[model samples]
Target: MKVREKKRPFQVFFHDNAVDSYLVTKRATKKVVASIRAAYYDNSSKELDARYRGELLVYQTVKVRQRQAEHAEKFYSVDDDHCDLQVDHGEATKRWCYYFENISVEELSHPMNGTRLR
Candidate 1:
């Protein structure tokens, strides 16, 4: 026998729209570079989480700027009932660790022309 389950997340939904996201800092870029340099680094879990959050910020911004007020997605405050113990550990790496770690600033900031880190 099997069962289906639904779960809530532990992420904060509130975000500032100001253009000062830290995913592309010079420091962050350096970290990304270093991670790539360290071949076979088994940190795909962390990297994937960063990448996922980065994409979310970009896509959310794109939606805010392009969509009308009523249609725009609203950022809501977190509620106690909605909170969960387990959080997203981020995506599982689909390729080698190096492939997952080769993220760059340009790609994070501009998804349309994201840098190919392969």
Candidate 2:
């Protein structure tokens, strides 16, 4: 008998500004959602980090609420750039939520390939 791992259902929410700005297509939205979901299931997913840190000009932050009555916050800055997606794992609710913001479609679609601009 094989035991199956239960997959958690993640909810992806976009900031009103982000939806109105760069998330103009279903494809783009799906891509972002998939990336976030992958990250949630596996914290060590290198592909997720590579997409944001290398190809895309998007910043991501991960925060896990501490398991304490005080409810302290532990922040993880994935990169040096400004945050585009604020991924939060709630301790009380045991819910995964992705807050999207600071989207730059043009820059993300066509990131510079190590070419210095004068």
- Enumerate clash totals for all models, in the order shown: 0, 0
lDDT of 1 by residue, 77-101 (tens): 2222335322222211232233446
Residues 1-118 of candidate 2: C-alpha lDDT, one tens digit per residue: 0111111111112334344343344445566677777776576455456755633323222222224423554553232235344344342122221223334223466656988879
lDDT of each: 0.42, 0.40
In model 2, the worst 10-residue window by lDDT is 1-10
Each candidate structure's TM-score, on Cα atoms with residue i matched to residue i, is 0.17, 0.18
Error of 1 at 113 (Å): 70
Model 2 bad stretches (over 4 Å): 1-24, 44-118
lDDT of 2 at 103: 41
